[model samples]
Target: VCPEDSNDSSRFMDLWYTFVDPYATEVDEMGTDEANKSVGVLRIKDGRKIIDAYEWKHDNDVHLLAQNDELIIYELHVGDFHEKFKDLTTKIEHFKSLGINASNINSYFFF
Candidate 1:
């Protein structure tokens, strides 16, 4: 269920993948004494339910970046670079040839 946050319009308002129940199919509106506003569970393009409520833990002992200056990050929009995700996978070799060790995709590509 999307607990609306107190933020301006520029900020993200809708909850993408917050609390999720694998057995449940819809969210119940508990505070709807005047109007009816209930919605079904959110799913991905492949029709699988989304569950991102798990807390992520990172280990710093691995030393992902020994030196910040040594990092070569390449940012790109998947839709703009290629229309399909399978097509983008074919460009991995191309990015490696350009010395791009890390890649970042904008969140807008998912929504």
Candidate 2:
């Protein structure tokens, strides 16, 4: 359990809970309910059913170029361009030849 000071209720209003159930396909929610009002994360692991706390992990491996203005941006819609990242990876050489250093992709790129 987290220290009371660390889990300060006043600062964190949204109670995040992870429901892990191998047989469950969707979360149950009613907009008015307290659980529904907060965040509910669905998790699939080994083989279990329970509620767990959610933690955020920041990506420290990403390196951005110092010169942002020099970046060559390419807007792409994953769904429209290609269904999956594997298909997009196949065109990496093409993008490199076109000088596309960065891309703005749809939020559902992994979907």
Candidate 3:
């Protein structure tokens, strides 16, 4: 079940206690009352719930390098590409021949 469907507070609290509470050292020390304020809670009818709470620290500010017009988008299925082209370089060459300046090929799951 997805976390977005939960609407019950108690079920959300239970989920927070079970999944997030175990790993949350900061929240544990703060006690349940105070912890409830800081952490988001959700409840579901089908016995599914989620606690959307975490400390996400970013080392640096995010910078978007690619602009809208500058981006060259290529959408293709990995399985289809693999079945069609046996070699990686050959596929890139084919894209190059078709006037594609830069080919962004996904190396299966890696790239």
Give Cα-based local distance difference scores for all models: 0.66, 0.66, 0.52
lDDT of 1 by residue, 6-30 (tens): 4454554453433445565557665
Candidate 2 local Cα displacement, residue 72, angstroms? 0.9
For model 1, the superposed segments whose C-alpha errors exceed 4 Å read 1-66, 108-111
**Cα error of candidate 2 at position 14, Å:** 15
Q: lDDT tens digits, residues 1-111, model 2? A: 445768564554556765444555445563585645533446557776555555557666787763787889878876665578788778878998998888887676365
**Which candidate wins on TM-score?**
2
- Flag the better candidate by TM-score, 1 or 3: 1
Model 1 TM-score, 2 decimals: 0.40
Question: Considering only N, C-alpha and C atoms within 3 Å, which residue pairs clash in candidate 2?
Answer: none
| Separate clash counts for every candidate | 0, 0, 2
Better of 1 and 2 by TM-score: 2
- Residue pairs that clash (backbone atoms under 3 angstroms), model 3: 6-43, 12-42
TM-score of each: 0.40, 0.43, 0.29
Q: Report lDDT (Cα) of residue 93, candidate 3.
A: 67
